[model samples]
Target: WVRGTRNGDMRDSPEESPEEQDRDEGSSPSDAKPDVTWLGTPISELGRMPDCGQQLPRLKNVSGQHTVLIRTDLLQNGKVPVPYPAKFTDTWDDVHVKMPWSGMNLFPVINEVMVLEPDAAEHLFGSLLPDMVQLALRASELCTKPIPLLKGGMNHSITMSQEQVASLLANAFFCSFPRRNSRKTEYLNYPDINFFRLFEGASPKKIEKLKTLMCYFKSVTEQRPTGLVTFTRKSLDRPPNWKSSQSQLTKLHITCEGTIEDDGYGMLQVDFANQFVGGGVIGSGLVQEEIRFLINPELIVSRLFTEALGHKECLIITGTQQYSSYTGYAQSYKWGGSHQDSTPRDGWQRKCTEIVAIDALQFRSFLEQFHPARINRELNKAYCGFARPGERSQNLSAVATGNWGCGVFGGDTRLKALLQMLAAAEAGRDVAYFTFGDSQLMTDVHNMHAFLTARNISVGEVYDLLGQYYSSVCKSCLSRRPDVSLYSFIYQQVSSSLAPDASDN
Candidate 1:
């Protein structure tokens, strides 16, 4: 389950394609035993639920073919491996999930979290197993309604209750939803939404993540959630005139200490996502996007319906609750306990939190991202994420983001930062950037912002200057110039362009 990755955005590692990775579901073996006493108290028998009561909601605008609500009882085709060409949500097979706890008992898996020993975890899971299954069973009901697949090139949004999100996450925990464990053709485009990958590798970070998820499960099992969340996939049919527009850069607040989740309040938070959205969260890779998905488990539901993001597409998730607090990034990541979310809600009861996921291109070589096409692609993706309804209007909120596609993606931080700022300028949004503990980067970006604002430069100037910089560095594109750092080049060229000329009118 330790797959390869390509980018700093935290995907499966570079060497492996998505198809080559995770061929096996990596679930525990069938021979694994359950604790009869569950370490002390008796494990409760699975309860017989009356017909599920939750009302299934569908998009009023379209026929209901796109959205598949889970009605487990109705899903009893009695097949282990589901029939081909069917989505798990559509089939809702009973054989994969029913009775006698197939594969391994969940006890030892919980022990590794160190938050709860096998005994304690068994007690908690075993006790709540009945109710958890009940929630999983009520998925069609708990959700405000069935969520439509966020297919590429289509603009769509779905609303679900927080209890609905938790219930769906509970389903993910049980791996009850079928056909998600492998990279099969039926669900090849989607990220694996099952918990099987969380148990893979059993690394310390994975353990901590499991603990955090368990905490989320515990809380939701105890209380009813009234808050709601919405997932919106926005696609741009037309983009801005980046090389011609005179739009000026907006306000920038750069910091190195705080993070996007904690520090970025009342702003559009950016998820440096992979094209596959949740990236490697269910697996061993725990980075920015994966960590965010784990902490806000509700976002995991998108994996059930969202397809691979198209180049011009971006995903916006509003009102997702952060169930757990966390420390560190990637492998150093650790799970802190429950976070009580209190953000104000809209009339629809959806939390006010808004997060946009924009996938950055992975550059195999240091110079790859500097290519004009690549630069424009990243800029376009960012612009798509930053652009909102009536986006040209002022009074838009600031975009909270950091160095996207840098680190393992091999993107130059200075270039990425400038591109994001340029994108924000075009979208009419300000930027609140976190340098991810890099004080020098924070200072450099802040100074760069100050220089641009002080000179009152146009967005097209920077955009074209970036193209020139790319052409200068990329010999194949055009004649070469002496290469310098991106910021230094920008400072020199922008100043020279603004300098006095003998032929001035």
Candidate 2:
């Protein structure tokens, strides 16, 4: 089962006129050669690492393996094959993070992090998943709003108010219900203060449209009704048996009878592995890595819309906001790692192989089995547009809502990491680390095989590395905007006696 992609409405039969098709064909003719490009070495074997000028260190536990980490800075050439627009969340530092375990809570309490505990992740992540979904959906909806189409020479693009765009992105990431009287920080309610704000100049029509969209979303789910809950009472409501449950799992489903149109706010249902699958470490040969893949239409919709808005695919990475990064399309080539002469070492190869076997079915089944629960949740919350019991209500006046959206899957950015690593390899760097997910580590290796064949350390080991990677990126992002406050500034901006309807100055 795929862990982190939502199923999408497959009915997009965009009619292409013959003229249009011919025009497109004329622009880029089909080639006889396959589009696939292997950066180095044979597909069957992991290659060796080449020496960079930098010194290399020995890997832990691999007394026999000569491992040296490689680092390089370079972008890949060509349109890397992104099957679908990949979905990824932009870290506060501008690093693209992948979506791993489902449910909306992208920002889990850093202090509360416990690797491999699915149940704990669910409770923490689920608490905010609904809100996150709402924000993503609302943002997408805003994108569909009527905008003043401004033609730029031959290309026509809608004019988006800088504020509107900021609002849309803020809504996508920080859009949340009003802070509860309780001081507990809700992930959904936190918007970044330094994020790009109001544009210097704005058109009246564009501003008006932004207001209308924001107001419309506000009116629909202001109360945060625990709507249409899905997932069987046996599977959802109560927590999962984390101890026996898979080590890493995320679940999602919709709860209601609404069609994709009218109230099809994208998200129908969602859940995740609650336990850490506690166990003692296995002996060297006995360690097992299991990835349960899941895909739901709601998630797909959420990702597609986000991809369009960000102009970046989201599927490749893994983990949560401020917690983990992705490695899918954006970093596929070098995500695993790189070696010299195009060969992947034993460690790098292992990471790449793990990437290939990712299961898409597990996630799909989680939703399929719980379809009834989703319908029931929909029934209970049908009174209001969207609902989530045991959670704060969405503020109708805010530009975003949690329940009205969907989520990206098991926050892993495998593809993006690989691509980045490949670019590094080409640029002649030693010991490069790709922070797309818990994976994406490379040392001195010559070919793809050498890099691909390297033994992967435990996910826990990788997790530690990721924590360091993300922390550095976060620091970099924070450094760029030291003066910006997050939620405090947002509260101040909207709290002025000025109602949203107030005319633009």
Which candidate gets the maximum TM-score versus the true structure?
A: 1
> Which regions in candidate 2 have their CA more than 4 angstroms from the true location?
1-453, 471-477, 480-505
lDDT for model 2, please: 0.20
lDDT of 2 by residue, 185-274 (tens): 321121111111222245332232233223223322332211110101111123222123222211111111111211212111111111
Worst window of 10 by summed lDDT in candidate 2 = 278-287
**Over the stretch 378-454, how does candidate 1's per-residue lDDT look in tens digits?**
88899999886553334456777887867566667778888999998888777777665466676688788888888
Candidate 1 local accuracy as lDDT? 0.64
Q: Top lDDT: which candidate number?
A: 1
Against the unseen true structure, what C-alpha lDDT does each candidate score?
0.64, 0.20
Error of 2 at 146 (Å): 36
